[model samples]
Target chain A: MNLDLRLDTSGDFYARKFQPTKREDTLILNMGPQHPSTHGVLRIILEIDGEYILRAEPVLGYIHRMHEKMAEVMSYPQYLPNPARTDYLHGLAWNWAHVAAVERLMGLEVPERAEYIRVITCELNRITSHLLWWGAYLLDLGAFTPIMYAFDDRERIQDILQRITGSRLTYCYYRFGGVSNDIDDRFIEETRKQCSRMKPRFKMFKDLVTDNFILRKRVEEIGEIPADTCRKYGATGPVLRGSGVPYDVRRAEPYSVYDRFDFNIPSYDTCDAMGRYLVRMDEMQESIKIIEQALDTLPEGDYIMPKAPKKPKPPAGDVYFALEGARGKIGFHLVSDGDKSPYRLKLRAPGFSNLSLFSEVSEGVLIADAVSILGSLDLVIP
Target chain B: MSEENAKPEKAPDKEKEVKKKEEPQVPKYTGYDYDCFLAPQELLKAVTKLDHADFFLEDVSCVDMQEGFQVVYHFDRFSQPGRVVLRVMISRENPEIPSIYDIFPGAAWHERECFDFFGVRFTGHPNLIPLLLDPEHQGPPPLLKEETALKDLNQLYPDRVHTPVSPDSEEFVKEINNCSNQKSRNQS
Candidate 1:
């Protein structure tokens, strides 16, 4: 047998079909369905003229698990674990959106204490998410030390969360009307300690990472996305705030006890990767503020509603619920036909919209800056 | 094929439209500030109106019902937060609706997702390929209900009316303009 050792010159179906410009010198490149900078299995096909990108298109669906389809077949309680799997970084927010949507549809009244618990735990989870994004983003831009610092804080928060939430990363602690486990004094005390501990770390994070000339040089004035562009693509969370919109679902919509908490939605008018970077940095501090407020005023009552429906059958209608996740706004549109399972369940993953704008933003930028742009978006592709 | 099927029914629909001029009744606590049914032709116009009002498209979701395919478009504004849902019904035999990608560029991905799952074709979409489904997979759209599992409009929306409001009408324009101005649930 003759050994043939030559690379396959032809590309995959997506790359082959990717239309190239009429220019003769333009070369086609596939960034990843496995490249580390993408954070997940997201593939971006690029048309390049030397170091500059002519056009870019992202090919998704490598990790699509069809969670919406799963929601239709599973019972309400059985489907509780699915949302957390979608955006694992901010798992609690997705978990909250699922439970809150059902609660809104069935007119369930959550105990005030349970509402406060949700707020406290959810903010903690948000901190972990932003921390991970911060570390991973810095790593993407060629720095490795920050991730160690990120996971250090992340693990402590996870330890506190695990004491109550049971599991560490992909949490399913939230139930329909309230949380699964009540936070004892130990849990609250540990959380308060973590909150106070994180305050000084933010200052250190600024000195060690944010103000570093190399990191700022890599991100600042790169990938400038106008506020109008964000609206056009429906990007949300820190990406939208980074564009100077100040439109956070927590503030604009005020879900749970968020209205009672005093925290500012930080926005930067620079509209570059630096703005997006600063927004996430500022947001982690705000999360600590919200957690501190919720913990201070922690109410007294049931954690989960006493007689919450074990087998909820919402009336025949539809309800739309949206909450701000770390990456962006996570939405759930549930249509029920008076059934135990949803008639149709549609999940509005923020990363899908946030990532869609990449093809447009990545155009005409240097390939290295393109990586900077993608990292700043902080995508957890579902 | 869909255009022809939609046209013949227009004459009779207009007759029903006059009798049902009373406000479309949605449940008070359904989380929708402004909900209206629009004819397929009026969808583009209504979306354009929303774009002019500085509203951002949240998502486009489609539900399979016995009556037809109910395509839902959700929009909200940053300045004034209120959800405006536009429901348009299209025949299942030829499930086609005009794309809003031109008006709201973000909708390109959403419309593709709808097409991928429900097989609802969005006409005029630039790249209508599958966004989250395997392109080589062999099957009907995965989200389509089995014939036995489908629910009709009456069963699903028992108490509400299903009249299509023309986008050109004063009520439609006023609703689009004032949707964000309405007090949101959280504000109360």
Candidate 2:
């Protein structure tokens, strides 16, 4: 026998750091920076004692593209499309957060109609994000049919958005002061039709998935996170709402024309994965209500601000603009020194804060239950 | 121990009142709910006060400038929704501050990310490994201050005046106490 035997000891950074402390009873497992169940490039390190997880740590930066560094080097206009790539699921929200932060710092006034367009498109994009999360989460839990149903509604909404915004996935529709293009009659009419169409699909989703008893057991009471835990770990979106706190960034800190929209922030006090699941299921309906209301009260004016600068050089100051993304509060902390490029552009990715609680939540949970809890978080890792 | 004592209290209506009393006295920064600058040492205390006030830590962001590195912590309330930002300026040479992970457990990853980028160390962070950066990452921190990229702090924050804060100054502690006492009143 070899004096010192190792399982090919020389590996990458993560592999070297991931050795098992107790070789006899404990096993360490790596679960993909390239896995489909992860939704994106998320690698979770799990230390297991038989079937129960003793500890779990997420190792990130596999896909870190240095977007913050890009924001510094790229001019203001050149950096417009970059934010969308950060959270591709709710691209518009990130885009709006960046543009809105710049606009606030510059003191530029957006027209009434432009604000409404921003509201409508952003909400539509949010519905798409939730739909995908719904479909993908179910797929993660061994269900394949619901994704087909979800994509049915998601594609149609994306179709309406594409005709106006000119992109389906990573949208750069929002400009500094307003939207890139005006929403025509066709876009509004088609959006209204889709909103009406999605209402019943949600009912069908409940009957097909939410009502399923097997799904309930997998989620309910599994990975239970109390309201105090959520606050301590700073988890937001449905994760926080599910834990019984009715904190919605839209209602909490009203930004743009969100105050004009009337929609309830759905919350559940169960503090379980099932609670988070229900909160999101109900939120899709609330988003639809917002879209319909905005269309009814859609004021007539230019979608893009008339005096909006082509290459904005905002005055020297720091502005932190946060908006309610489909996942949580998306914030853009912009520090400008009267330059076209941001001196410091810190993207407060909601997923980053929301995902930080995974280690605490996954502790003492079954491996399968941990998977369920991760999906319920609705992560769009940046 | 103020926090642990107040935890078992089940009074919902009075919870807001007590929280408001202990909240910090943050200056009214337009667009933000409350804004205050803290010496590097006060970062942990101010954040702990916010955590006790039921405010969730939003993000831990860093800005590299000519003077030093500015670490920004954004927080918001659930019961009474408001944004509070604590800006702490650390000397560029040392670039370390006391960690708030003991208070807000969520700050763990955020602090690591800041460490990965601007190379700002959180003194008490348990796991300060590379979060969003590969440990094999070469060169200086990706967002390190390049000569051409640096901006004067005064020019960057034209509207807000920077009053240098000594780590053990009485004025800083008093300001934090006032802000901690007035959290609910911050809603306005």
The true-versus-predicted C-alpha distance at residue B98 of model 1, in Å, is 0.9
How well does candidate 2 reproduce the true complex, by DockQ?
A: 0.30
Tell me, by TM-score, which candidate is best. Answer: 1
Which stretches in model 2 have alpha-carbon errors above 4 Å?
A: A1-6, A9-11, A18-24, B1-29, B164-188
- What are the per-residue Cα lDDT tens digits for candidate 1 across A35-125? 9998889999999999999999999999899999999999999999999999999999999999998888777888999999988888899
Error of 1 at A86 (Å): 0.4
DockQ for each model? 0.36, 0.30
Interface RMSD for all numbered candidates: 3.8, 6.3
Instruction: Compose the digit string of candidate 2's lDDT tens values, residues B49-125.
Output: 67666788888999888888888888877776667778888889999899998998898988998999989999988
Q: How high is the CA lDDT of each candidate model?
A: 0.89, 0.83
